[model samples]
Target: MGKCIICGKPVDGLICEFHEEDVVFEFEGTSPSQLTPGRYYRGTVDGYADFGVFVDVGDHVTGLLHRSELDRRLESLDWEPGDTVYVQVLDVRDNGNVDLGWSIRQADREFRGSLIDAPDGEYRPGERDAEDESSSADDDSTTADAGPSTNGGDATPDEPAEPAEPAATPTMEIEEPDAPLKRTTVDALDDQVGSIVRLEGEITGVRQTGGPTVFELRDETGTVECAAFEEAGVRAYPSVEVEDVVALEGEVERRYGDLQVETETLEVLADDERETVATRLEEAIEQQARPETVEPLADDEAVAALENELVDAATTIRKAVVEARPVVVRHSATADGYVAGAAIERAVLPLVRDQHTRDDAEYHYFERRPLEGTVYDMDAATGDVTSMLEARDRHGEQLPLVVLVDAGSTVESTDGYDLLEVYDVDRLVIDDSHADEAVVDAVSVAVNPTLAEANGGAVTSTALAANVAAHVNEAVRDDLEHLPAVSYWEEPPAAYVDLATEAGYDETAVTEQREAVALEAYYQSYKDKRELVADLLFGDERDLAAHVSEQFRDKLEAELETARENLETTSIDGVTVATLDTAAFTHRFDFPSANLLLDELHRRERDDGPFVTLGLGEDELHVRTTTPVDVRELGETVADAVPDAGVRVVGGRDGHVEFLVGERDSVREAALDALAETLA
Candidate 1:
């Protein structure tokens, strides 16, 4: 009988049943069947395979430590061949194969006491000494026949055999190699499959999958995926993140027809090594992200005039993708806004796919969100901030770059821009509205023809975005050739019309596509609906556009008929002023929104003389003027004339103002009287 080393309780072996897991055993037997299941054992690493590592428990018995049984990724283990490790025998199959499970306690000092599992029985270190002394004394009579002692001491027939020295504790010492490994580039890895190499670069992305964590490593030459495992579905190295400079050693292998590196050792570079790699990546990215020239999709004086700003905006978007920063696009909820946002989306998705190794990279890296109005207000910015912060906190992602299309050009969006600035987020604006000069100074890049004083007639937001998209990725130029014409409600420019015709879309086809997008844009004012929008704009479903357009015309014509019956017209200073009480006569929440109905009514009722259309709601009023009217100036004049009405301009780009609902009649009278004097 023996005592349990942990509790000092009397037992039949060195450990009791309750403390068997506490002590690690050294397997002294030579066959797989000798391994006792649920007992921890010391072993040596033999080699590696794709599924697991082979370990030699003794001279003749070998076991497999499968990747699934590891607490961390198999590749992340730094153990080389012949190195000592600790594992538990999970099972011994009938075919003489032993299965091993991971052991959290790896070192000899972690256990209560080390013991040997021999064919006879288990014994502690001191017990082995007593057995050696007994053997030498008992075998003295056979010394003459044996003639020599196996022990390292002289023995003669006349002299008694000496006791063997106290047996020493078994230990292993590993030596580190004196030479450093050779470094290799990602581009050169294809020729070195099945060979181990070292790499130094920046991590562009990190994604956790069902099996391993895939880190996208980028060098000056190219990019590749390096996989590391700590456990099933667990992150291999939690400290490493995107944009971190790293030195990695791994074996190059092919997985699912794509080249992947199985990481053996990964360390975040420091000091001089980090600086050298960072500078090289910076220089390469700068040269690749910026296009040498900006080429317009078609010959238009307006687009040519703002070439420099277009290039700058395109470069900013391209650099965001290369750096693995998400791109969030915000645009107005209108046909022109949808077309503009979709054009850029079409160009950016291809680049995201090329840069990332993940299958869902396009959706993760690029997003398009539609705004309720043509302003990036605090509500919109708050939603964006919440989502972006969540992504960064949960996934270790970099903050995104905000891109505004057909919006964010006026002073109302300054507060939203300021909120993003607090987090050091980048912003880019592309619009055709009369941009406020303050907006130009707030964002990183602003592309507006009005800022450049270009005289080309009626430059729509879609026109500007399409040219920028072409420059961002010229491969998608043919896909965007017809978008500019679809954004125009009336007669488009001759150049865009010809371009659309050459792309196989006629005038009717373009109009149908525009109307369909506008209807879908109204239903879900905030969601992206990427797939549905793509089908409407670029898909081959002709009947889809036709069907949606039919519903758009039906809904619009009915609203127009009801509005014309309620409209009241009067002449003020030789100008026709048409007014409709939208709150009383219109469907406030349904399709053919108050704004769309008013636009159609004005187009049908206008004459050669000066004309103005007004749609008055409970608390707001929409304005449309044949001549240029500064809505801001008009609101100031009316507010002063009717002080009790509390009138103020709420939306400058959309030409709308707000007032107290209680004094709706008084505000209406005062606004008309103010308009009479201004027109006169």
Candidate 2:
């Protein structure tokens, strides 16, 4: 019975995930190539899930090797998790999750072994040496854990090592045991139960369930379920990311015949060495990154360009937990042909939620809401649906594919997803070689940019929020004085109103205007916005025409682009214009009700240059842009246009709008900067 020479856990119960693989033999079509289903092939276990191990048997295809199919001796195999091992595909679900199975009992003479076998004899004959006792004693601590931090068991435990460089600080701290601390590595918690030990890794699950907050903790050693009793001093859990290394302070709590560590404290780990470099690099990169080229953006591209900026400008809460805002949602998956008996392209699931809201709801006023969705592929790219590992070989990248996903987000019992867009997928994975960022730079060949490209080379808001949360964690850990430094603060908009009138106009207005109906205009704008979003974020050609009619699609496309471009930056003196252009042509553009006359004067500074226009005129309001930047007189001047309508002029010392309108205006004007105090 072979065991994981490190953790001493039964391979049968342990899971394997496919991160690296080699295409031993080329398949026929560049498309779905079929081979004997039952054949055994060598590959690497990327990682594990509750369902099974994903084995990368080359061919850019991975197989799901389920735990049930593996023999009891699976507990003893010394194969490196990412290092290659023989695997047999059991089943590949349609939902993109894969399962694999391995058993020494079922394997040929090459793999046959007993669980009692140690790492020295079967797995690596060369690793065993007479003088290797020192290496064994020091390295055994790592055996209990195998993950991104593992480097072929070569870690020198006797020395305090220097941290390397990643774009972010990747260090995590481990709170030592209170007493005779079990110096066992995380992987070692697997077998022969003893006093629970402490290990640190990323927190994958932070779900409050079964009367306590339970989470899945992972490190190079392996993954284990962790539960908090509320007494562990963890008031609230941090939204740690999947790839991020977090410091987990807890003890082993075995339950249901399974061992899962229970955690109390979770602290952000800042690998100080890399923090300086990553922080500098991050700032440099942002300074260098430019918005996607625009100018001829069609209807969809129009809004997307703007939306892209909003996504970029949005306040990112590093390692923050925010839902995805899917203005236009679609579904797709990565599991195609390898293990599945047939190709299931037709099968699709709801990939995301629609970013819309009901009228008058508190959350309704907000354009972007929280998003909740599942990731079909862990290594999927930004613009493409294929996995990054797969993209590496196909595109011949200089670096191994690295996808940043908040894969660690968890809600209740639902599995969390990562909003990853491969801005830079580095290096090629050739026969499992050590590829780094430098190698990828050498290959520096560019492929079509993914979601980042489609959305003007920016990540989605969902991604931004997650990154922000991560940034927060890092800032705290790295003690980044520049970050977490508040430049401004205030309350949110309280007396805000929608731009369009909620009357839901009819088509009769279209006949009178000789143009498409306002409803058609709005719908077309919506469709175009969604389509542009699809193109920008997913690189999918989801068009606005799909949701709108041809009659208005051509007409409203340009306006939609304008509105999208001004996203996030549309705030005029802190008053967000919202989607005014789109609402102009929609069925119901909720009336701002904020004293229309004042708004007219507010917009006077628009394009007319030096006109001091005033009063609400025929089908339009007059604006006076050349007026002095004085507040009281502007309010009084604007008050004249209202007749009986309330006029309100806002802003501070610089100036404000003066018009005639309702109490909504004057009162709102007084409360001007109050609403935008926060981001102002």
Q: How close is every model to the real structure, measured as TM-score?
A: 0.72, 0.25
In the range 1-680, model 1's lDDT, one tens digit per residue, is 88888898999977898989888998888767888899999988755543577677876576889877998876478975567899999999876768899999889999877889988789886678898989988798577566666455476667777777888988887888757778898768879989998998888767664356678788765667898988745789999988889999999986534578999999999999899989988898788789776779888898899999999999999888877778999998888999999999999999888766544468778999999888899999998998787556544567899999999988989999999999999999999988888998889999998788887788899999999999888889999999999999887999999999999899999999999998988887777778888999999987899899999999999988899999999998887899999999999888888888888899899998888899899998788888777777778877887888888775564457889999888778777876777666
- In candidate 2, position 246 carries an lDDT of 56
lDDT of 1: 0.85
List the candidate 1 regions with Cα displacement exceeding 4 Å: 1-197, 204-216, 221-225, 231-238, 251-260
TM-score of 2: 0.25
Residue pairs in candidate 1 whose N, alpha carbon or C atoms collide under 3 angstroms: 72-230, 73-229, 73-230
lDDT of 1 at 501: 96
Candidate 2 local lDDT, residue 66? 56
Candidate lDDT (C-alpha), each = 0.85, 0.31
Poorly placed runs, candidate 2 (over 4 Å): 1-197, 201-207, 210-212, 216-367, 370-532, 536-538, 542-633, 640-645, 650-680
Ten contiguous residues with the weakest lDDT in model 2: 337-346
Displacement of the residue 585 alpha carbon in candidate 2, Å? 12
